[model samples]
Target: MTTLPASAFLGGFALTFSLIVSLGAQNLFLLRQGLRREHVGAVVAFCILADILLMAAGVAGIGRLLQAVPGLAAWLTLGGAAFLAWYGYGAAQRAWRGGAGAAAARAAGTPLAATLLQAAAITLLNPHVYLDTVLLVGVAGSALAAEARPLFLAGAGSASLIWFAGLGYGARLLAPLFARPGAWRVLDGAVAAVMLLLAIGLLASLRGSLGIGQQP
Candidate 1:
């Protein structure tokens, strides 16, 4: 039996936590669900499962397949950007209208299946998810000795589990603050801004890839 250094597990945990701690599209959606207190368990579970599967596939060399198909990345990026723009617009409209309390009431009545589907779209459709889990994390895992890969994956998976659980459940602690429509408006506005910024960033990256702004 081979003894893997503790660094493998620690490194994976730290890397994954840092990557996901940011306020990206997935995080925004998760936060919204958490705040709304609707299907939080299902949403968090799906997200954690998705991360584990993606990271595992990446470790198993799926990232190489993705790299071989550059056009797919472009397409995914385009799709993600368009979706973000649309979602951002909806959030902005909600913020402007200021019926968040009512909206939450309505969202509470939303079906679990529908909620899961939305969660799926948000998690699966984002190219950055692939980039982070498949390419970056995957490549990192592949670099490790075979025996160490499991420890790394365990660490990474643990981070996702912990983070999502906290984000989903911890949000209820702010239920009092979110009880106010005004607070919802502020949150929706912030969500809109973050989504739009992320969309713009994706578009910019796509353009750079296409060499659109380079001076000849």
Candidate 2:
């Protein structure tokens, strides 16, 4: 393998961070896990690993193959929208019945397997993740020479690491603020709103796709 300049690594890092820094389903889930102080390490690690694998695959040119498959993206989007709607309804219920005691109980009672499953769904079910990681990042990295691609991947992976680690661990600093039932209610309400909004957006996209396909 040939050595590449530090710019390749920095470019990857900057680009990946820019793409991922937004508060989406995955990031919101991680933030909630971090706040609960339940399996924060496992959740963060899983997210980082998942992101790296997707990025690597993107760099490996699997993005094109995925795009070539008909209806696959739409199917994923449908699944994601349904999951988001269900999750949002759950959050709304929690928000409606806000109580510090209930929140604490939930934090303590949630199973690790279940948490990880939600993490996986939040990460993998969303078509945007594939588009951002595989198509956008992958395409950018592919433009570089073969030797420089690794450096780019390293940079992108580093961004995922730094972002998830900080989001997970740094949430402890807000424990004092979230100590109140009111705070829990507000947070859950916001989460519910965002999740539902995202679900609606996904469904709208699918509708648009269907409309376009139906056109003569």
Candidate 3:
């Protein structure tokens, strides 16, 4: 048996937390689900599971495969960008129009299966996730001794589990505030801005990779 390095554990936790704590499409959607009191468990579970699987795959040398096929990354980037753009447009529309009616309608939320499917799509389809969680984080894990890799991965996985659980459950605290239609609009608008910005970033990266003029 080998002792795990404390530094490796902490480093993995910090890196994973920082990468995921930001306001991205996945977070935005999670927040919305959390606020709406929908299938937050499923949402959070799917996200954490996705992170673990991706990270594991990356550490297991999937990153090498991804790096070899640059075109795959390009396609994922474009697809994810388009998805983000669509979601952003929808969120913007909701921001502009959501009111008491929207809040009330929340009770009749989307089907659980559909929600889970969409959640899966958002988590899996995003190209940045592969880059950040799988390839980058995986490389970091690989740096540690094989014995320490498990600890590093545990630390990384812990961040995902803790963060998603907190975000989803803690969101209910704002239920009172979200009671106001104006609040929903504000939240939706914020989500829209974040999603749109991310989409633009992905699109720019794709363009740059493809040598598409000075678009950025």
Candidate 4:
């Protein structure tokens, strides 16, 4: 068996961290939960665990299977896009109505299972997660020498753990800032903007995939 270099591990870590750092649905949901101070540890752990599971599958070659199934990808992408768009619209509506922060904070009163389910939905419902992790990351990891693969996996896993942890815990510090109504409005506006951008990007990608917006 060959041993992977430390550099390979670092490279993998950077890739994973960069990819996960985006302001997507999963991150936004986690951030909201964190701000509410509800099951912060559980939410973070679930995200990290999900990342580990997905990364392992990617390293194990499941990503290739997903790539080979274009039909499956299309269906999953459509479903994920619809869900995201709906969620984004709903969030935006709530923000526009005002008191969204308080409402979200109150939602923290729900059962732990409910929160977990919400997190899972945000993470697993999106087909892009599989494409990003299993296919893209997996293919990248496969390019390294056999010995370096494990190091790369370690780096990616570390990024997930660190990122989710920071997202969950760091949100608490912003609670005081959000206590002011104006600040809450700004946060909601920011969240709405991120959600809308993600939705638009997904739709555009789907249009391109369907050959609806191609140049002659």
Candidate 5:
């Protein structure tokens, strides 16, 4: 059995946080839910728990199957890119049409079970999340010295707990701001921009892989 050092734990925390702390669909949805104070605990718990499971699976060599299958990563990247693009476009349209608040309220009205299910679907369906947690994080964890693996995982798990809790609860602090229609437009617009940029970048990378573009 491998154990991790204190330093390894710190390193894992930083690395894991860097990868997961992005403005993706999951984060956006969680934030929206948090702002409305609807199913906030459930959403945060699901995300954090999912992260723990996925990250552990990755570090346990379960993610190695991905490395074995050729072009698997590319296919996932393609799918993720497309999903991000569509999601971003929808967000942009909502923002442009000034319907973000309405949409959010409708979503909030959804049952807790449905909201949890949606959150799970959003995270599990995203190929990028699997790649990041299982493959990338697992591979990195596997590389740790025998004495530092445990600490590393601890650090990574801790980061997930901290980030999800913060993101889910922190949105409430901005409730007053989001209450304003103009603020909704700005917030939605920002979300749209982030999603679009992520999508474009993913697609560009895929294009490069296929030799469709000399420069991405």
Candidate 6:
């Protein structure tokens, strides 16, 4: 095994953080769980573990399944994007119609099993996670030398660990603001926007693939 270069580690860290920093279902759920102060550690661990496995799989070139069969990725993306759109629409409905409200939603207090299962679903069931972590990050990391791949994986895993830790633990700072329904409205609206934007991107990718397949 060759010595891992600092550059490899840094590259992985920067790239992972850039992708994970974005707002998504997983992050939103994490934030909610944090504020609710329910099983925060389990939630954070599940996310980090998912990230690590996905990133590792990506760096190992398992994500090439996406390129090997774009059709597969496209199909999976279609279903997943549809689900995301529906989720976003629900959030939008809540924002506009004044649905359960944040505190009330929190008070609903799902069982820990249910909460953790949802967390797993958001992380593993979501097609975008596979696209971003396995396909995108994997292809990017594959650009590095073979010996440096481990360092890259380490960096990516570290970023997930750090971000989830901070987000879950630091959520209390926002608890005061999120207490207000108005604040919940803004948060839900932001979540809807992110979900819709992701859906748009996924559909666009499928369209591009179809376009390419039809040509010559």
Candidate 1 lDDT score relative to the true structure: 0.89
Pairs of colliding residues, candidate 6: none
Per-candidate TM-scores read 0.93, 0.94, 0.93, 0.87, 0.81, 0.82
Prediction RMSDs, each to the true structure? 1.9, 2.1, 2.2, 2.6, 3.4, 3.2
lDDT of 3: 0.87
Per-residue alpha-carbon lDDT of candidate 1 for residues 26-94, written as tens digits (9 for 90 to 100): 888889899988889999999999999999999999999998987998998898888888889988988
Query: For model 6, what is the error of residue 172's alpha carbon versus the real structure, in angstroms, after optimal superposition?
Result: 1.2
Candidate 3 ranges beyond 4 A from true positions = 1-3, 214-216
lDDT of 5 by residue, 1-216 (tens): 332376789887988899988878899988978877889999999999999889888888888777788698687777766766776776677687776655665554879888887687668757778888898888898887766777888999999999999999998999888777777777778878877787788778777778894764
lDDT of 6 by residue, 82-189 (tens): 867877887787677554664576577778798788788667757779978998889889888898888888888899999999999999888888777778788778
TM-score of candidate 3 relative to the true fold: 0.93
Better of 1 and 6 by lDDT: 1
Q: What stretches of model 6 exceed 4 Å from their correct place? A: 1-4, 97-102, 212-216
Query: Any residue pairs clashing in model 3, and if so which?
Result: none
- What overall lDDT, based on C-alpha atoms, would model 5 receive against the true structure? 0.81
Between candidates 1 and 5, the one scoring higher on lDDT is 1
Tens-digit per-residue lDDT, 1-216, candidate 3: 334577777888999998998888888899899998899998999999999999988877789998998689888888888888888897888887787666656767899998998787678779989988988899999877888888899889999999999999899999999888889889989988988998899989888888879655
Reference-based lDDT, residue 100, model 2: 61
**Whole-model lDDT values for every prediction:** 0.89, 0.90, 0.87, 0.80, 0.81, 0.82
List residue ranges in candidate 4 displaced over 4 A.
Answer: 1-3, 100-108, 213-216
Residue 162 of model 1: what lDDT? 98
lDDT of 2 by residue, 1-216 (tens): 334668899999999999999979898888888888989999999999999999999999999999899799999999999999899898898898877655666766688999899999988989899989999999999889888899999999999999999999999999999888888788788889988999999999998987865656
lDDT of 1 at 33: 90
